[model samples]
Target: MSLATSPATAATETRETQRWAYPALLALMALAIGISASPAPLYGLYADEWHFAPITTTVVFSAYAVAALVSVLVVGSISDRFGRRRVLLTAVATLIAGLVVFMTAGGVAALLVARVLHGFAVGAIVVAGSAALLDLRPAEGAATGKRTGVAFNIGITIAVVGTAVDAQYGPSPLVAPYAALAVLTALGLVAVILMRETHRDGRAVALHIARPRVPASIAADFSFSALGVMASWSVLGVFLSLVPGIASRAAGTDNLVFGGGVVAVMAAFAGVSQLLAVRVPAKRAAITGDFGTAAALLITVAAVDAGGRWEIVAAAAILGFFFGLAFGSSLRHLGQVVPAAHRGEVMSAFYVLAYLAMAVPTVLAGWAATTWSADSVFTPFMVAVALACLLAGGLGLRVPRLTPDAVPAH
Candidate 1:
C-alpha cells in the first residue's frame, strides 16, 4: 500500500504503539506508591523481631525520606535529557533491590539500606512518570487531561489501599509486604520494557542536570504551594510514625487492618479532594481545607488526651477530611505554576521541601515521645501545624489570583 494512501493504517499503528504506554506508566506510579507505604504496616513486626525502639523505627522511616530528598535534589531533572523510560526502568530495578533488602532484613542496617534505596526509587519514578504524563498529552478532543488527573489520583489511592490490605492480611508482616512489592516492581519493569519512550533525545545535557531555577514570577506562587505541601506531608509523616501506636493504645485496635485503614482513609480522602479541586477555585479550596484541618488537629489532640479510641477515630476522620483538601489544592497549584519544560526539576525541589517536612518533624516528634507522654508530644505538634495552616491560608488569600496567562515559569 502506498504510504499516503494508507494514512489510516499508519495512524492505527501509531496509536497501537502508544496505547500501552500511558496505562503502563500509571501502573508504575501505583506500584511505587504501594512500595513506599508497605513498610508502615510491617514496622510493628520489625520492632518486635529486631528489638528496636520507637526512635529507631522513626529513624528507619526518616532515612527513606532523607534519601528521597537527596535523590530529587541531585538528579531530579536528568530524565528530561536522558529518556524517561531509561530513568523509570532504573527506578524499578532499584525498588526491587530495596524490597529484597527488606525481605532479608536482620538488623537496623538492612532496614536503613532498604529504606534509602526505596526512597531513591520513589524519587526517580515520581519525577520521570510525571514528566512522561505531560509528554503524552492527547489531541484536543480527547479525554487526556481528565485521564491524567484520574490516573495520578488512582495510583496514589491504590498504593494506600494495597499497603493496608496486604499488611493486614498477608502471611508474614515483615516479609510479605516487601515480597509483594518485589513482584509489583518486576511487573512494572516488564511494562517499561514494552513501552515506547516519550522524552526527546539530544536536548541540552546541561539543562538536564542543572538545579531548578525558580522564575521570579512563579517563586512566590511556588512558595505558597510548597508550604502547603510541607504542612500536609508533615502531618502524613506523623500519622505514619505515631498513629498506628496511638490506635493500638487508645483505640485498642492492634490489627494491621485497622492501622492501615486509618492511614488509607486520609489518602482516599485526599484523592477525592483532588477530584473535587477540578471544580473549585484552588485558593478557596486551600483556605477552607487548611482551616478545617487546623481545627481537626486541635480536636484530635484533645481527644487523644481524653484517652478514648472512638474519639481518636472521630478526630482522625475529621483530620483526614481537611488534609485531603489541602493536599489536593496544593498539588493542583503545583501543576499550574510549573511549565512543562522544567517540571521535573521544579517538582524535585517541591518534593525536597515536602520530604524534609515529612522526615524532620517525625524525628523531632520521636525524640519528644521518648521524653514525654504521647499526648504531651502531640499537643505542641498540633499547635504548630495549626498555626502553619492559618499562615498558609492567610497568605493564599492575600496573593492575587493566578490566571492561565499569568501562570509562572519554573
Candidate 2:
C-alpha cells in the first residue's frame, strides 16, 4: 500500500514550506530589481560606444520608467486572476530576456527596447511578488510585506556596487553584469517554481489590462497611507538622483565613491529600521515616521551646511531610518486593512502612487533646479516635503490602528 499523509500533516507541511518560501521570494525580488539597475554604471560606456546624445540618455532611462508605469497599469493586477506563482514565473522569464537583450544591444534603439522589457519585468515583479509575500505569510503581511521595501532599497544598492565594480575591473564590462544577473534570476525562477501557489481561487476570469482599483474595505485608510508613502519615497528619489552631487559639494572634493557611500549608508539604515519596525503598532509607527522624515531632512540640510563628512553619515542614517519607519508602516497599515482576495490589485494601486511620487516630484525639482540655482531650489523642496509629511501625520492621527477580519493584527 502507498503511504499517505493526513490532512493535518499536509497543512503543517504546507506551512513549513511557506516559511522557507518567504526568504526565497524576498531574494527573488531583490535580484530582479537589482538587475534593472545594472546599466547605471555602464551608461557612460554605452554613450561613448553608440555615439548617443545626453538627451538620448534621458530618453532611454525614461523609456524604462514609462514602461514600468504602463506595466503597473496593465499587468499589475494580473496575479489576482492567475496565481501569483504563474505571473511571477512569467515575470522572471521577462527579466532574463531583458538582461539578454541589454547585454547584446549595439545601439540606442536596442537599448530602449531592453529597458522597456526590464521595466515591465520590474513592475510585474512588484505586483506579483508583493502579493505572494502577503499570501505566503498571511498574518504578518504588513510587517513581512514591508520587507519588500528593504529588499528594493538594498537591491539597488547592491546593483550600484556590483555594476560599478564589474564595469571598472571585469574582463567584459558590458556583458559581465548582465550575465551574472541573468544566472541569479534563473535561480530565482527555480525558487518561484518550488513555491506553493498561494492564490487558490480557481474561478475563471477574463484576462485583460487593468486599472488599479482600491476596494471599499480600505479606501478610508489608503489616503493617509499613500501620503506617508509619497513623503518617504520622494526622499528616496531625491537622494538617489542628487545626493552624490550633494556629497561632492558639501565635501569640497570630487570623490565619486564617497558620494555613493552616503546614499548606500542611507539605504542600509532604512532596511535596518524597517526590520525593527515590527515592535511598534502600525499607526504609531507611520505617524512617527512622517514626523521623523521631516526632522531628518532638516537635520541632513544642517549637516550639509556644517561641512562635516561624518556629519553626513549621521544625517543619512537619520534620514533613512525615518524614511523606513514611514514607508514600512504605511504599507503595513494597508496590508492589515486590505481584503485577502483583493490584495493584488490594492497593492498595485499603492505602488502606482508610490512610483508616481518617487519620480514626478523629483523630476519637477530637477526642472526647477535647472532654471534656478540648485541652492535656491533646496529650500522650497525641503519645505514642500515637510508639509506633505505633516499632512500625512495629521491624517494618520484620525484613523485608529486597523485590522482586517481575515488577518487580524498580532
Candidate 3:
C-alpha cells in the first residue's frame, strides 16, 4: 500500500531545500559574472597573434556589451513571466556554448560570436539570477545586497586570476582559460538545475524593449544616482576592456599574471568596499564613490605616465573602492525611491543607462587611442571622470531622499 508523507517531514524537506537554494543561486550568479570577464586578459594575446590593431580589441570587447544591451532591453523580464529555473538553466547552457566557441575561436568573427553568446547569457543571468537571490534570501537585514556584491566580486577575481595563471603557466594560454571556463559553466549548469523555482509568476506577459522612464517626483534623485553609476561604470569598462592590455604594455611585459592581477586587485577591493558600505550611511557612500573614483583616475594617469606596475595596481584598487561605493549606494537609494510594482522596470532602466555609459565612453577612448596614443586617451578621460564625480557628488548631496509610495520595497 502507498503511504502518505507526514506534514512535518514535508515542511522539513522544504526548509532544507530553501536553505540550499540561497547559496546555490549566489554561486550561480558568481560563476556567470566571473565567466563574463574571462576573455579580458586574453585580448592582448589575440591582438598580437592575429596582428590586429588596438581598435580590433575594442571591437571585440564592445561586441559583448552591445549584445548584452540588446538582451537586457528585450528579454530581461522573461524570467519574471516564466519560471526562474528554466531561464537560469538556459542562461548557463548558453554560457557553456559561448565557452566552447571561445575555446576554438580561430578569428575575430568567431570571437565576436562567442562574446555575443556570452552577452545574452549575462543579460539573462543578471536579471533572473539576481531576482532569484532576493527571493531565496531570508527575511532579515539587507543581506541579499551584500551577498550580491561579494559573490560577483569574488567570482570575477577567481575567473580573472585563474585564467591569468593558466595563461602564464599552462601549455596553451589561449585554449587553457576557455577550457577552465567550460568546466565552470558545466558546474554552474548543474547548480542551476538543482535550484528551486523562486518566481511564482508563471503567467504569460507581453515582452518588449525596456525603456527608462523617470517620474518628475524622483527625476533629480534618479539623475544624480544614474550619473554616479555612469561615472563609476565607465571607469570599470575601461579597465575591463583595455586596461589589461595597456597594463601589460606599460609594465613592458606580457606576463598574463600581471594583467590579470591588476583587474583582480580592483575587483577584490570593489567587493570589499561593497561589504563595508552596508554599515556606512547611503549619502556618505555616494560621496565617497564620486570623489574616490575621481582621485583614482588621477592616480591612473600617473601610473600610465610613469609605467610603474605597482602604481597601476594601486590605482586599480582605489578605483574599485569608489566603484563599489558609488554603484552600491546609488542602487540602495534607488531601492528607496522605486515602488515594488515598478522595481523591475526601473532597475532595468538603470542597467541600460549604466551599460551605455560604460560602452560609449570606452569606445570613444578606444578611438582616441587610435588617433593619438593610449596616454592621450587616459589624460583626457581622467579630466572627464573627475568633473563627473564633482558634479554627481555635489548634486547627490543636495537631492532629497525619495520616500517610497504605498507599495513595498521589492
Candidate 4:
C-alpha cells in the first residue's frame, strides 16, 4: 500500500490544529497587547530627549486611544464578514510596521505615526481576535470571557514591567524594547498564519465597515455595562497616561524603572482581582469596582500629599484591583445579554464608549495640567471618577441582573 496520508488523516490533523487554535489565539492576543504597552514607560525619556511639553506626552499617550476609538467605530465588525484570520493577519502586519517606526523614530511626529499605527492594529485585534476567541472557546458566556480579561491583564503587565526593566538596565532603552517586541511580534505573525479560520462561509455583508450601533433590545443593558466600562477604564486611562508623571512629581524622582513599576503594580493588582471576580456577582462586582475606584482616588490624593512611595504603591494596588473587578464584571454582564450573531458589532459599540472615556478625559487632564499645573490634574479626575461611580451604582440597580439561562448559547 502507498504510504501517502489518507484524506481522513489530513482531516484529523486539521481538526487537531483547530482544537489548539483557541489557546494559540489567546497567546497571540497576549503578545500583541503586551507589545502595544511597551512604549509607555519610555514616554518620559522621549520627552527628555526631544524636549517636548508634558502635554505633548499626554498627546502621545492619547494618540493610541483616539486612533483605536476611530478604528473600532469604523472597521470593528469587519471580521464578521471577512473572516478572522484575514483580519488578524492584517493586524499583525500593521503592528510590525508600527514597531519599525518606533525603532527608528527621531521626533514626536514619528512617534505619533507609530502610535496611530499601533492603535489601528490593536483596535482590529481587540475586536476580531476577541471574536475569534469567543468562537473557538471551549465554553460559553462569562467563563470564556474571563479568559480574555485574564489574558489582557497578563499582557499589559508584561509590557509595563518589561519596558521598565529594559529601559532601566539595557543600552538604548527606547530602541531595545521595540526591537525585542518586533521579534516577538514576528513570531506571533507566524502563529497567526497557522491558526485555523473561525468564520463560517457566508455571503459577505454589503457594507463591510460601518458605525457600530446597539440594537434596541440590548440598548438599556448596554448602557449600564458601558457606564461600568467607562468608569473603570477611565481610571485605568489615568494610570496609564498620567500616573507616571504624577508619581514622579510626587516622589521627586525621575527613575524610569520606578515609574514603569508603578504602572505594573496597578495592573498586577488588577490581574489578581480578575481571578477573584469569578466568585462575585456581576452587579456587586460592578458596584465594587466603581466605589472602590472612587475610594482609591482619595487614597491616591493622600499618597501624593504624603509623598511616600509605599503609599503611592498602596493606592495603585487598590485602584488596580477594583479596576479589574469592575471592567471584567461589566464585560461578563454584557456578554450574557448580547446575542451571538451580533457579538462583533455589539462589543465594538461597547468598546467605542470605553476607548472614548480613556482618551477624552486623559486629554482634558493633560490640558488641565498645562493650563493650570501638573498638581492640578488628578484632583479633577478624582472628582469625576467619584461622581461617575455614584452614577454607575444607581444605574446598576436599575438593570436586570444576569443569569446563565438569560442568554441561550448556540
Native-referenced Cα lDDT, model 4: 0.78
Of candidates 4 and 1, the better by TM-score: 4
Model 3, 57: alpha-carbon shift in Å?
1.3
Where does candidate 2 stray beyond 4 Å?
Answer: 1-21, 37-65, 80-82, 101-112, 133-143, 168-176, 190-201, 208-220, 252-256, 338-346, 372-379, 398-410
What lDDT, from 0 to 1, does candidate 1 have? 0.72
Count the clashes in each prediction. 0, 0, 0, 0
The parts of candidate 4 lying over 4 Å away from their true place are 1-15, 74-77, 215-219, 339-345, 400-410
Candidate 3 residue lDDT tens string, 1-410: 12465534543454466787777778878888888888888888898789876667777777888888887776656776776788888888999899889888899999989989999988888777777766654363277877887899999899999999999899999998889788877887887776667765335767666776766667787888899998988887788878887888888888989999899998999899999887777766887788888888888778877898888898888888888888888787777777666666777778888888877888888888878876567778877988898889898878875663222344
Query: Tens digit of lDDT per residue, candidate 4, span 257-362?
Result: 7787788888888889988987876667877787787787788888988888889888888988988887887787777777778876887788878988888777
lDDT per model vs. reference: 0.72, 0.75, 0.80, 0.78
Task: Rank candidates by lDDT, best first.
Answer: 3, 4, 2, 1
- Among these predictions, the greatest TM-score belongs to 3
What lDDT tens digits, residue by residue, belong to model 2 across residues 1-410?
12475534544465676678878888888887777655655655675688654445545655666678777776634777777888888889999998899889888888889989988898888777877777666677555666787897798778766766666678888888888888888899888888877665445666676557887757778888998998887777666555555655787755545565677678778888888887887778889999999988888888887879999889988988989899988887777787777766777688778878876776676667667744567667877898899899899888754573235433
**RMSD per prediction, one decimal?**
3.9, 4.5, 3.3, 3.5
TM-score of 3: 0.92
Candidate 4's TM-score? 0.90
Give the clashing pairs for model 3: none
* TM-score, one value per model: 0.86, 0.79, 0.92, 0.90
